[model samples]
Target: MTKSDPNRILRRLPLAVGGLGAVLLLINRLLTPELTESQARGDVVGVILSAVLILTGLIWQQVQPRSPDIVELIGEEGFVLAQDLPEAVKTELAWASHLLLTNTVTRSLIVYYQGKILLRRGILAAKAEVTPGPILKRVLETQKPIYLVALYVYPGRIEFDYLPENTQGVVCQPIGNQGVLILGANAPRSYTKQDEKWIAGIADKLAVTLQE
Candidate 1:
């Protein structure tokens, strides 16, 4: 489920209230409350307003959900690679990075291998160096990927200052036990389940390539 799932459910609040009002109004009509002519007019007005509320709730439910607002990142399009990498490994990294940037929602990518920056491509930050903080370190030790579907809510995002600033989402995919593939997206919660699986497969392939 997405981070906004709960918020979306909360939108039903208006419908719930409207439903309750309808029920109460139905019962009132059945009981046939004694009232003057003016009171009956007011009652009619209340019923009309209740119907409007129900209609509004139905329209709200049908409305499409909008993507989360994320500030655009400040950076330049660039590519960087570790000079010590073998030609084969360099070629593999370049191919993977290019595919991810062009095919996926990824706007910035970084491959940190064996304690060094192996590749940096797509929109790049000013600083070339990367320091793994709690989040990246945890992912490496656990050997499990961490998907920050929405980064603005997480304070740990600060550690990825080397990535394009204000990156909306991040995925830390571990390569074997020594490397982490960081993918930064332009919009929050844009990556789907299929995208995650594809990224994991890419990481597995990179781990083997780097080892060779």
Candidate 2:
């Protein structure tokens, strides 16, 4: 069975029990009449149990946990590359960015080198400037990548004005000591471990190409 099968089963269990209880109640009436006080009390108890089960089933279905709906963000779709970049570097940037947008959960990306915004691709925000916030600074200083799962929960998200403001997740992959690869996803907790590793590989490649 699939992962959702368990939830489906749990969801149907109460209804099933209610249905069985209701059927048994009807069957009991045909089998025997509740003429005695004890028999009538037992009948009332069965009716109460059936009602509770049915009510619980209806409530559980409404409150069942489901996947979060990621709203489609409003943004411009394009890439802005700084002029004077070498043709080889530009090609490498384009190829890598394309791969990321197509293959991963990334909905937006920015490539920063030294103090310049070398590339801004995919769904871009209205702003054109990007100042390295504490998170970005930390990544560059320690040369360690940071994955911000569910970007909406982080205060540092305010610094990423260059990416779409409603971006659900982000990956800040440091490129050597002077550059960083910023990837924004369409959904929270969307990127897998393998995706992060592949992104690091691409960032390394960009570092080599940009420096050359």
Question: In order, what lDDT does every prediction score?
Answer: 0.87, 0.88
Model 2 spans with C-alpha error above 4 angstroms: 1-68
Q: What is the TM-score of each candidate against the true structure?
A: 0.69, 0.69
Error of 2 at 42 (Å): 28
- Residue 158 lDDT, candidate 2, scale 0-100: 89
Model 1 weakest lDDT span, ten residues long: 1-10
* Residue-level lDDT tens digits of model 1 in 19-96: 888788778777885767876786687788778878878877877667666566779989888898789988999999
Residue 53 lDDT, candidate 2, scale 0-100: 94
